[model samples]
Target chain A: MAGEASSGTFLQGLERGLAVIRAFSAQAPSLTLSEVARDVGLTPATARRILLTLEQLGYVRTDGRQFSLTPRVLALGWAYLSSLDLGELAGPYMEELSAATRESCSIATLDLPDIVYVARVPTSRIMTVALGVGARLPAYPTSMGRVLLAGLSSSELDVYLANMQTEQLTPRTVTSASLLRAAVDQARADGYALVDQELELGLRSLAAPIYNSRGRVVAALNVSAHASRSTPESLCEEVLPHVLCAADHITTALKHRGHL
Target chain B: MAGEASSGTFLQGLERGLAVIRAFSAQAPSLTLSEVARDVGLTPATARRILLTLEQLGYVRTDGRQFSLTPRVLALGWAYLSSLDLGELAGPYMEELSAATRESCSIATLDLPDIVYVARVPTSRIMTVALGVGARLPAYPTSMGRVLLAGLSSSELDVYLANMQTEQLTPRTVTSASLLRAAVDQARADGYALVDQELELGLRSLAAPIYNSRGRVVAALNVSAHASRSTPESLCEEVLPHVLCAADHITTALKHRGHL
Candidate 1:
């Protein structure tokens, strides 16, 4: 899209159909026909056609008025997750990190304004929101997101910040683009990002990047805990080293597997 | 498809596009242009259009000759997994079962001739084949498959059997349709299924059905182990009780969550 010619070959029907699927998020799992249309910015008739197509394909299920997705949808993702091998590759290191820190460890990559968790190892601390695989968090406020942001090229980072919609999730959340840019720069310089009580009131986490064989940052690994579990200084002193080591181990594993 | 009238407004483009996405699987993660066209039963020109659209949309990536799926495809599955809430609901139960048996615990539902793993709590035993979430296995030989197949109505099960292409994965795998039917009935009668060295030479597992509040069996939960760890007799004598209890707990949780 940035440089290539997409007009002659682009498939609008495919795009619209996928957009309709995207309209349903964790916050709004099920949506009425009109809601889907509105969310995807399509007409009612167009939305209905796409929804009906998806329903016919067993990807979407409708119960009279509202429509939701089915487990069959996972078949679409199985190809990607299995091929990427991130979850299987990162699982052991994450579990060890979780055990050592007595907290959850997650691996995530950037997905625009949000960071999507690709894998996780939990210490059984159930939070208000269930942060499982494929869970997303705003990139501006999360340690993993900041590390991922730091991995981006300067121009790409500038473009993301320009389009980012920052929310004041906590009192410490930095909403200004200039400050967020500076934080990303600091993360790049320090080789890690420590976010304290920014994403949530009682959350403290630090993250480091996982590189591929080519030495490009492919994902971020983070150890997340309750603020009461450790102060920011103690987290840096105690957990940051483990976080960095685990991330590097994952990177080395990726290289050993010949993934660039 | 059995009874519904799908005349006009089926959106063939959407259908074909999704078919292209489904062409990639764990065994065949990447495909060339002609391979995609041949596998998907689409003309090379049409397949090229869909592939280009997916590439621009960030779901597919190609390196000159071979095209593979990207993690962005996980977004499509995220909607369904999160909405179903099974992974979150079944997580704690699966962990407990895995801990108790010192083996991997998984939950799966029927998807035609296959059972797709929806949730799993794994032990750190790296196998030749990595079994993680979204992994699919032939339904004829797995304990979970038998349990789920038993849950289907007689007519539905018959239809599935008629279409199912059973392969003798191991010497112990039952390939006869009548024998498979008998096995499913036995599972239904006993409220559990134990598959011994059927899926693989050294793998053994026993599964129990997880029912919704409406008493409809929605998923099957299983504890899978190596034959060295447990004999068929010991698995039934020592591990069957925990597997049944854990699956029942998941059903209760689903009921509490008002899934049905």
Candidate 2:
């Protein structure tokens, strides 16, 4: 895969404009012109120009002093999701799994050190951190992340490990590179991964890899529950079967639809 | 509200870059360099530069010959969705409505002549067209669209009517401008709208307006089903109450969360 943009062909203005868009977050929904400037490390005038361009494109809306993204911004993400077609293909199966397990179920893909949820079927709110589609969590500590990481080639895994921070999110989170590597290896060998409160206290999850027609793991499916409600053994025995079945169902559907 | 971008302040480069991004769709996931240029009305050189820039920013990925958006592109949409916080607040209620009605339920906001779905819960596949978050459908032919249009101010409604293209989506679709206005007025008077097979053959839906804490209609909630499965009277009697209740629930939740 091509790694870097050759400087002769890159557009720096486009990058800066996207950076300005990325500067807004849930915590900072509306930002002043100077706030956007500071967040993206650009001048107020430059930020204003980019924001104005976004506004013109119908992506951003300003309420006099503060600027916030409009619903039109969702179209950008929708293009990606609709192209993937994961939600349409896997949604029914996920709903069934969520109902069967009475726990939250999600499908995610690895984005380096983080796993981004592409589709989710929530049964109950169990996580301290709210989980939804497009929500990201650390890869090493999440069951879905570990399953995705296990799908990577050895060289790719090495590169990921080299840059991985392995921060201690919870006391049970494995921080050591060797141990995390072993866990990923185990996930590959066992065809599933089960993490007990690694990402947060009282949260346990089990995940399995979802393969495409090319026999490549394109995504990971998981069933997450409270630790008090599900022991690791119970999760492995009960939820694991349901999650693996749902993953296979999604894989088959994707392959049949030529989406794989 | 700031309606338009000031002419002299906008960055044309940013607008062109986003146009390049928007050019990709579900029907065309990957495009060659020349194809991207032709699709976006840009020169091959400019398209290559923008693609290279997007590649550097990790939003676009290349498979040697073809270029497709990477999962990172979801981040742009996620920023908006997370900021809106609509999916988290309204999700469970939508699910409940879908379960109670055994149909697909969604919440959408008016984007002028189109309605953009913000949150959805699907119980079954009822329409030939797949409906998901960010999916836009013409407002005049959809239940949610009528409710949202009815919520608009008279001036805004006039602006919409002036520019509206009333296409014949289905035989039942109201194409007459005056008739469409009557439908909008009826929606405003009844506090709900029931559309019968206007968007597609054998599809019916009912929608109700959702208010923010400020008592402004912020969104519309709807339940859709097959025409054979649900008649207009059945939809109004059985599904309308659940939809309206869900709308009220969402509005109350948004109010308590200070999202209004």
Q: What fraction of the true Cα-Cα contacts (under 8 Å, chains A to B) does candidate 1 also have? A: 0.47
lDDT of 2: 0.82
lDDT of 2 at B102: 86
Q: What is the DockQ of candidate 2?
A: 0.39
lDDT of 2 by residue, A173-250 (tens): 998888999999999999999998989999999999999888889899999999889889898788888988989998
Name the best candidate (by DockQ). Answer: 2
Residue-wise C-alpha lDDT for candidate 2, range B94-158, written one tens digit per residue = 87888899887888887776898877766743221256567888899999999999999999998
Model 2: residue B223 alpha-carbon error in angstroms: 3.1
DockQ of each: 0.35, 0.39
Q: List the residue pairs that clash in candidate 2.
A: none
